[model samples]
Each structure stands twice: as C-alpha cells, then as structure tokens.
Target: MAIVDEELPTTIFDFLPCFFQVIGIMVLVSWLNPWAFIPSGIATMCMLYIRYRFAHCSRDLKRLEGITRSPFYSYLTSTIHGLKVIRSCHAENICASEFFSHVDTNTRVEYLFLTTTRWAVIRFDWVTVFFVAIVTLLSIGLRVFGRQFSSADIALTLSYSLSLMGLLQWTIRQSVEIETKMTSVERILEYCSLGQETSVQRLPKYEPSINWPSHGRIVFDNVSISYFQDSPLVLRGISLNIEPG
Candidate 1:
C-alpha cells in the first residue's frame, strides 16, 4: 500500500518545480526559497522525532499482534481437530475464553497502532498548513513593504507557495509511511535469515536397488492422526504391511 498509494504521489510531487518554475510563471518563488526549505526542514525534524519515539512502540505492537494472532489460529485449528475431545474433557469454556482473550488483545494492539498513525498524519498536516502560511506571508510582505515584485510576480509566488507546500506534505507523508513499513520489512528480514533444516536429517541415507522400489515394503506399527495437542485422535491403533515388488 505504501508503494502503490503513498510513493506514487510522492514521486509525482517531485515534479512540482518543473510544473511551476520551468514554466516561467514562478521565477524567484521556486522550491529552493529559504521559506520553503526552512519549514520543510522543521517539519522533517518533527517527523524524524516522531518516528524515533514510536520506533520501539511500533515493533512491539507488531510483535504483540503476531503473538496474539498465532495462538488464536492455533486454538481454532485444535478445536476443529478435537471438538469431540474438547467437549468430552469439558474444556469448551476454557477454550472459548482463551480464544476471546487472544482476539481482544490483538484488537487492542491494532487500535493503538492506528491511533498512533493518525496522530502522525495530523502533525504532518499541521506542518503543511504552517508552511503554506509562512510562504504566502513572506511573498505578501515582499510586495507590500518593499514593492519588490509586480502583481503578476506576486500571483506566481502564491501559486508556487501552495505547490511547494503540497510537495512538502507529500514527501513528508511518504517518509512517515516508509518509516512504519520498515518495521514489517525488518521482521521479514529476520524471518529470511532463520535457520533451515536439511532433508537428509529425515530421509534415509541408504539407497534402494538400482530400479528403486522394485521390492519396496510398506509397514506401519502405530500411526495416528491428530492435528494438535489436546485434540481428539482422528486415527489410532493402525497397522499395515504391503509388499508389491
């Protein structure tokens, strides 16, 4: 969503200067103006602070949500596999309570994460508004006090001011989104670096006859089917032997 939604507009906003200054309508009122850069810097600093402050919180929230979700799914699978055993053991209430607790915890963490996101959005919006006002005010001051620019130039300045603010807002919003998205990215990287088991540990090293399975024999001493712990056995006490050379 960040790449598709946020990054797209952010890249488009990169064309703001070309859209304005290149057209000769806004000459001195380019994004390189001190008014634009100063406020942009301040807004960026604020966003950086916010990201740092919420950095640990965001990771913890994702972790908690993952923890809660896994157990809920585990419980569901176990329940489906062992409904009869759960009922027989009279653990229906306990199971239901555990499921609800997981759900409730996950819901709370999700809500908190959204709230933090909204708070960041609002802060960026305020910065955009303030930046716009500063640019407009400076342009007007230049005209009224020093008569340094003509009406046409003033109009151009105002337009560029608004455009610059939009560009600033877009860039900052994308930065915030990427910051949050990085948490998920970091977790994925961690998962990618996990240890993997080799099939040789489970498969026999011995090789069969050259024709392979020519005299293969099948045997089963005790094989059972149970999806999870504390679940009813779907199959048990099974034995079979088949030789088909």
Candidate 2:
C-alpha cells in the first residue's frame, strides 16, 4: 500500500468506512476543497434570481406576440379572399397601411424579446468574469503573501478555477435556454387544458343524404367557421345558391 512510484491504485472502499450511505462522506473527506465553493455559490445564486425574474415577463411577452400576430394573419386571409373587391374599390394603399399597423405591435414585442435574452447573456457573462477574477486574485494572494502553497499547488488551483468558470457559464446558459424554450410547451399545455367539447350522440333529425343534383339546386346559409377561438369567422353567414342544368 506504500510503495514509491509503484503504489497500488487506491480504493478506499476495501480499506474501511464502506458501509451504508457513506459515499458522499468519503468523497468530501478525500477531495473536497472548501474554498472552491465560494465563487461557484455566488454565481449559481445570481443565475437563479435572474431566471426567476425573467420567467413571468418572458411568458407574457410570448403570449402578447401570439395575440398581435393573429390580427395580421386575419388581415392576410381577408385580403386574399376579397382581392377583386379590394382592387375594384382601389384601396391598396389603405389596406397596406392597415396591415402594417396590425403587424407593428408584433414586431415591437418580438424585438424586445430577442433583446431581453441578449441582455441576460451579457449579465451572466459578466458574473462569470467577475468570479474568475476573484479566484485569480485569491490564488495569487495566498501563494505569494500567505506563503502556504507551493508553485505546483498554485498551478493546480489556477487550473481548476479556470475550468470551473467554463462549466458554470455553460450551466447558466443552458438553464436559461431550456426555461425559455419550455414556454412553447406551456402554451401547448394551456391550449390542451381548455375544457374539451363533450360528445352527445343523437340521431340527426334532418340528415342530408349524399345524393347530388336530383333537383339541380345547391344552397348554403348562415354558416360560420373560425380556426382560433374568439377570432372572427373566416366565413360568416356566407349564403350562396348554385343551379345545375
């Protein structure tokens, strides 16, 4: 167990204290550096606070963007359906203005949403840089002034400190990204959670047969359909009649 340069690979489990839930205790007692946690703890707390602060606002902004976009889509559908009417009325300029007006709200919110994410990234990076600086200063101070660490010890400290910074930044960035992306899932879940229409089985009092053109007349009246709830129907009371020879 104590040969120089030919020592057996250490396995603490076979030696002693290998019972029950004592694995973490072994790790801490063997390799834990108490000083390493300081900067990491600070960075983690700051990351959590920023994530929490942005959560509600980010969701609301995303929802607002959806609302604003609906108007533009409706306008596009309406314009396509009534192209001849629009051209006959000579309202291209007016229609274009209205479309842009509807789209303006969506553009503003989308811009702000992107900017907000960039702003958070900058802050997270700043926090990481500040932590690295603190670690560097402390390592040098302890080695030079305190004279408690050898050159090899200082090198090890610096290496670990730098490595941990990259890991910390990646963790923060990934956490924010996942949280932001989950908003889409939340929206889907919300839509799904809306009470579903119940089924009621009944015989139709007036079920029309598929036989066509027996009398050579077809008609429709007061029919409405909307893709989104609360949206205006794409076709409203569109009454029409067709005659066949």
Q: Which stretches of candidate 1 lie over 4 Å from their true place?
A: 1-36, 54-56, 196-245
Q: Compared with the true structure, what per-residue lDDT tens digits does model 1 show for residues 70-131? A: 67888789889999999999999998998888788889988987777677668767766876
lDDT of every model, 2 decimals: 0.65, 0.65
Candidate 2 C-alpha lDDT tens digits along 51-128: 677665676776677668779899999999999999999999999999999889889999988887777778777876
Candidate 2: C-alpha RMSD after superposition: 13.2
* lDDT value, candidate 2, whole model: 0.65
For every candidate in turn, the CA RMSD to the true structure comes to 8.2, 13.2
Best-fitting candidate, scored by TM-score: 2
Residue pairs in collision within model 2? none
